[model samples]
Target chain A: MKSAQRTTRRPLALAVAALVGLPLALSACGTSTAASSSEAVTEISVMDYYNNEPDKSFIGDALTKCGTQAGVTIKRETVPGKSLISKVLQQSSSKTLPDVLMLDNPDLQQIAATGALAPLSDFKISTDNFAEGVLSAGTYKDKVYGLAPTVNTIALFYNKDILDKAGVTPPTTWDELKAAAAKLTAGEQYGLAFNANPTYEGTWQFLPVMWSNGGDEKKIDTKETEQALQLWTDLVKSGSVSSSALNWTQADVKDQFMAGKAAMMVNGPWQIPALDKQPTLQYGVVKIPVREAGQTSVAPLGGEVWTVPQTGNKARQAKAAEVIACLNSDENQMSMAKVRNTIPSKTTLAEKFAAENPKLATFTELIKTARARTGELGADWPAQATKIYTAIQTALTGNASPADALKQAQGQ
Target chain B: MSLTTDLSQTAAPSSGKASRKHGRPAGPPTEAQAPRRRTRQRRERIFQWLFLVPAVVYMALFFGYPVVKNVVMSFQDYTTATFFTGEAPWVGLANYVTVLSSSLFSTSLLNTALFTIGSILGQFVIGLALAIFFQRKFPLNGILRSLLLLPWLLPLIVSSAVWRWILDKDSGALNRFLGDLGVINTGVPWLTSTSLALIAVVGVNIWIGIPFNLTILYGGLQEIPDELYEAGSLDGATGWKAFRHITWPMLRPVVSVVLVLGVVYTLKVLDIILGLTNGGPANSTQTIATQSYDLSFHEFKFGEGAALGNVLVIISLVFAVLYLRASRRAVDE
Candidate 1:
């Protein structure tokens, strides 16, 4: 009986031992393969957040083209927009970061501050001729860590038929905008729609108005900022803009505009393709309205920047830098800009891009004066952005007066 | 003799000695035989324990590790950089302090309580009514009962998205139908108004939870034998009186289980609220779970998020303990 029991226990112990050993053995095999492969990386991996189409295919083509230029076969990976940073952080901890990484421009500083990215200067990559806003966005501690080929900013997109029918011109100043919006308001449709949801996107939309009104982010409680908040509150209070603007995303705003429930919207050039899909929806783009006649529309710059992450693989890092450079070359920038409905980040290509794509002339001009969200606060922008959006929500929801909302949010 | 007498003789030597003292028939155990018998019993106990090993290992791997890690994380200053640097400096109770003392904490707590209570009450009351309604022998009752589960079958996110369109202020089907009936002059701002967002979110959540409650309660109702009802009728205890005495008392166990499970599930509900309102319109619908996610993912404040998450866990644990006690008392009675 003892001999038979020992036999049974031995097999059970062996099975438990195997179950414990399997994960360890598999992880060991994984690290060994990675170590061996990193020694001579013929194919460097690239990761980005272009998970949607047209932009995905466009970026894919550019990456493949750049990979050929760098003499490396590219292994591209794409995650959804929201999960890219989380994926990067996960890879960072595991010491298995991709050779090439794409970060939304405002996110570059936060990621670079983690010491996970190699400065472009390390690989002798040129950082010349890029627009100042985008350059500032990709810079951390005065070191250029990433580069964007094309950039975009929000502008006032209006339905031509609605404006024409209402005999209202595209508003150029805050006062003009208010009057035009109020005049255009009719049954079952609001005069304007813009996102003021309690999110960073809401903060982004409000920046153009706030900055144009001389509302500095550094001191958000100032009268100038209050004026911007009051503008949104007034629009909602006047019933010219939907109270539902508090819940609409930029996409939702676009949908309302297309559905004729909204005559104008604050949106980016990315909506051009979707707008073109509806042939009867004639729309015109202009700079986001200014506070006064001479005040510039300093819209927040929006774009994705490519960087070479510090993956401890010198060969792959060098190759990734080459791909980054090739992607930012004027020719590739112009091509990508055309396909993605964005303007090249290099100011020198503005005239050429504008002449080639006349419909985006307003955006081309707007890009020159666009401001980077992180230009002032660096890694601290998210905190300030949260404050801005909270204030927007408080004011828009009528929970507080504009001045009181700013005061309360700034306290936070 | 029998196996019982033989086992007693070998296994319980002291008892056998006592029996001998009382002048009963007993075989005295030899020294070598006693040790061998002890070993055999020990081996059998080990065999019985082996059957539970898989479950114990699974719980340790999945539940134990995460709970321990989350507790450890709540005491540290974990952030995005910590993921890369692996240097989570100890901050003691600072994370908990920040989370508890924040301005939004009170709002989020109130919202969480309201959301859970509102959802459970709505789901249970409506579910019980439907379950009782279906107890009758109507035509196509089985098919109709099965069809009622369609809402629960669809994914929460898909339902949330569908509900979002249906609840839109202007172009929504709900407003359109209301307008056709001349209910109001203008569209009701369902999800966009601070006053109405929470109620709208709760309505959608109730819709999602009804099917689950109905199914469980229906099963419990089916388990109660019909003879009790027949006897209650003989005593003139029909209709509401029968339900009060016969059905309610017997259904307490299942009802407690359903309500406790519902509260637990509703307390952790993030996806439906996120997909529908995203805790927007001035954070009117911002529950503790959504706020925790916002802290961890949006603000990258994992430590504070874990601290808030632990608070939710403790709340759920309190409910779970109360449930266990209630169910035990019911069994005793």
Candidate 2:
């Protein structure tokens, strides 16, 4: 009787154990199958955040073209812009990072510092002829880990009809900008619009103003930065710019411009295709204003760079590097630059690209003198960027004066 | 008569003692029969436990694992690099200390309190009023009651997007309506100004929470028997008097449940605020949940984020305990 009881209990226990173990074992096998199936070098996966139209198609075309050159079929994946870094980190931890990964310029340093990306030199890829700012953006500790074919920066985009009616010629100096914005303010419309929300986009929009005035991110609590902050505050206080600028994104700013609610906006060239879609909207682009007449405008560089992540597969990494090289080739660079309304990263191609696309001349000119955000601080740029936007929010919302806001944001 | 006699016999203490005295006399059987009977009872108990095994395993895998992992992570120096290096050295309570001492901690705590309290009060009062109103017979009452749940049916992100457009200063419907009514020449900066952002956010949250509160409270109101109100009304209790004596005391359990759940849900609200203002206009709307998300996803400080998340969980746990106690007392009464 005792042995029979034991036999019944043992089988029941075994059944319960098998019930739990089956699913776990199946999942483990599933992951192993996916890992082992990629042994052949016929195909490599690429991931990026170009999930929007025109960019989605444009990037697709470039990847397909590059895949042909590298003799490998490409499997592409795209995630939303904001979740890309988190997804990359997850993939890194799982040891399943994509062969070719696209990272936004400012994020490259942080991701590269993780030791998950192979330096371009490892694959014998040359970094020559790339623009200095983008080169520095993709570099980590003196080694280039990524390359960008085309780059972009923000400029002053104005409504031609509104400016023509208001007799404004797109202000080039700070005083001129203030007066023009004030003069253009009318019923149901503000004179200018720009993003000052508490995000990196807001910080990006403020960089041209700050850098043009000789403000340095390394020392954020300076008189120059204060002056820049005060300019934005004065615009809000005088009612020349909308108080809602604090909530608007760069996209929202463009919407306001297209809606005829604002005459001028500080925006980037990424909006060119959208603007062109509105046939009745006449707009012009110019460099963002400087503090004085003689000072040159210095905008921050904006773009995405392609890198070969360490996937622990030598052949796949080599193929990914070839694709990256093909994407950054001179011919592909010029073609992508024109189609994307961005300037080529190679200086030699910029003049030709600009000559072909006259509408983006202002952006091309601005790109020549653009500065990379991570140039000075590298991985520490995000902290400073946060501080800058915090100061902007504090000053614009009347929480503190510009100088005091900067001081407080610097935690002094 | 027989059923009544059986019930009385079972209820009597003498009958229970008599049964105990005769427990084995009538059931005396051979040893084989007794072992088989015991084995059969044991098998029945095992079968009952088999029904609970799936739920136990699920709880262990889902809730149990993440919570334990979070508690462990909070004590480590986890960052972006840690993903590659896998070298998250334990730092004791350093993460908690850093998060608790940060300047934003107090501000976030205050905002969380204000947001939760302001949202709960607004949601409960308005929801209760609506629930009471719907209790009255009217035309299309059922349809109207279900229609009111549309806000709850829509995704939070969608609602946030709709609210963002509605609250815009220039082209928004609210501002345009106000302007047409000659309320003010300039549009109110609903989401841009620091003074108004928290209020606007709270208002939006209240709007989102009303349907949930209304549904639960309405169900609770329905469970109260009509005879109770009829009885109360017979004793000069009508309208306010009836509600004061009958509805209030009977609805206590449901009210406690709703309030505690509301507090827990409101405490971790991130999507609406993030979609609308992103804790902007100088951090006027920054709550602990949003701050934790920022620390983890945005700043890649997973350890600090876990620490902040644990703090929020502790707060929720306190409210949960109070709820359990209140519910138990209600049951006892």
Candidate 3:
């Protein structure tokens, strides 16, 4: 009986051990580290910063269509607009970086400084066809890293009714602006809405006054810089513009203007769609006013570039460059302009795209007068820029002198 | 001597107990022993192992290894990127120094401290009072106790998001109502203002914490001997004075656990603040948790992120030690 029981249990023990061992052995075998063939088409991924659903779809559609026809597949990712550079930096560290990417214009320098992205001198395209000043803005270390995608600049968006009620035209100089703002100041109807919450807007608004006074941020912190800071600070403190304006978003200003609370605003073409969204409001768009005589109008030079990621087999990388070249074509530019409401990067295509879409003409003019901000600010750019608005807030809130605030900012 | 004597006695019992216990006069082959003795030994071994396995496995996976890994990582300069790149650089204390000197580090520490002090104090006081209120067999007392937990039942994100809507400048109910009543001039920048945003986040967190406090504390209050209170009442103790003299001292242990956990939870609060303000208006509301995320995601500085995470671990370790000491003292008393 004992021998018989031992015989019965022996098979059961062996069977159970086999069941356990089989799965472990299979899993261990399945997890083998496989290396890819160098000669194979190395997949290159591309990241685009068209976070808005419409823009994302538009870019997605075009890239999908183009990549399909090329007989090479392209993997793509889209990121939110608010944190493009930061997101890209994080992605870049994966070392599986997309062979193509969209980066903020100013951050191209910082990207270059890091040596994480490749320069585009090797890619074959008529980069000269790129809009003037775009090359300058996107160029870092004497190498091009991005294909200029558009030329975006600042423009004044005003509520026609508010301006009419104040009986004032958009002010063209510092004195006229102050005068008009003071005149527009009435029972809760402010003349202009600007955020002291530092942003690209603050820098864009800051420089025109300096340019009008024959100064630049790179050359010197001139009297014009001080004067311009004071001018806006005074407007904030005078209650002509709500000091709270320093704290509100450009979107908030747009909402205020649509509601008839704000009369005029220093904004760009992006607001036209939002303004047009307001059914009750009558609005006008115009070039940013000249700060001084013979001073060229300016908004920060705003645009993006397309560059290949550092990963990929040679063939796929070449194909990626081909896709970028195809995008640089007038056909692609016009298509993006048609679908995205963006001005074309090429001067000639700019006119073509503009003629097809009349609204883009406003942006074309703005882009010509644009100057890009510095890129050293990196991911902290938003926080550092917030100090601009904070400075403005301090002066408006009666906490500090405008000069004192600006002086403190120079150190920051 | 004991083993030999016990075995010899068992050997001699080959004739006696087996016949009595088994009752079937079966032949004993080798030995006879106490019938329940083997069962008792096996049971004692099983219970000992059963008690040990859960705690051993838990400590091995969750506590022991993680603590070891964290300490090792603290001595290295590594980021998430380093995981793919293989070995990380040796930075020995550089990361710790950077973390210590950073504005992000200091500001977040201060913010977390305030949140802990405010939220813990509010939850304890409020929950204890509610406990006493509900201790009596009053009408709808059960229903009221259930209703009180609704705040804790609501998801933190849900509460924060809803509160954010309530505090909106133009469309918010708070601003609109206050402005309509002539209580204020215009929409208050409740979230946008640097001074006001952190307070708003903390208020929501405190609200979420109250229900847990109430339930645990109410249960604690129920367990207290009624005779003690009766004696106190006989001695003329009543109302607030009675609670001060009787209820509080008895409920101290429960209160300690609630307060310490609340402090730890509040100290590392990221979601409430992030969901509400994202540490904006110049990062006035930035906390260590938010900064950790920013460093990892925004800055992509993984080594620094690890350092920050280790700081939180160290803080929790300190709290654990304090809790251990206090609980032991309470038990000894």
Better of 1 and 3 by lDDT: 1
Give each candidate's interface RMSD in Å.
Answer: 7.6, 9.3, 13.0
Q: Which tens-of-lDDT digit does each residue in B1-333 have in candidate 2?
A: 243244334433443344456554544354645555555446654764686578756754666556766887899998888776667899999999999998889999999999999999999999999999999999999999999999899999999999999999888888999989999787888999898899999999999999999999999999999999999988999999988999988998999999999999999999999999999899999999999998888777899999999999999999999889988987897
Q: Tell me, per candidate, how large a share of the native contacts it keeps.
A: 0.43, 0.51, 0.05
Better of 2 and 3 by TM-score: 2
Summarize candidate 2's per-residue lDDT along A202-314 as a digit string, tens digits: 99999999999999999889999999999999999999999889999999999999999999999999899889999999999999999899999999999999999988788
Candidate 3 local Cα displacement, residue B188, angstroms: 4.6
Model 1: per-residue Cα lDDT over B1-333, one tens digit each: 243244434655554454467665666665645666677667754765586578656754566556766887899999888876778999999999999999989999999999999999999999999999999998999999889898899998999999998998888899999999999789899998889999999999999999999999999999999999999999999999999999999899999989998999999999998888889788899999999998888877899999999999999999999889878876786
Better of 2 and 3 by lDDT: 2
lDDT for every model?
0.88, 0.89, 0.67
Number of the predicted model whose lDDT against the real structure is largest: 2
Candidate number with greatest TM-score: 1
Sort by DockQ, top down from the best: 2, 1, 3
TM-score-based ranking, best first? 1, 2, 3
Please name the candidate that would achieve the greatest DockQ relative to the true structure: 2
Off by over 4 Å in 2: A1-40, B1-49
- The list of candidate 3 runs beyond 4 A from truth reads A1-44, A49-51, A79-94, A106-115, A151-154, A185-189, A198-224, A266-268, A374-398, B1-112, B134-165, B168-172, B185-201, B222-236, B274-317, B327-333
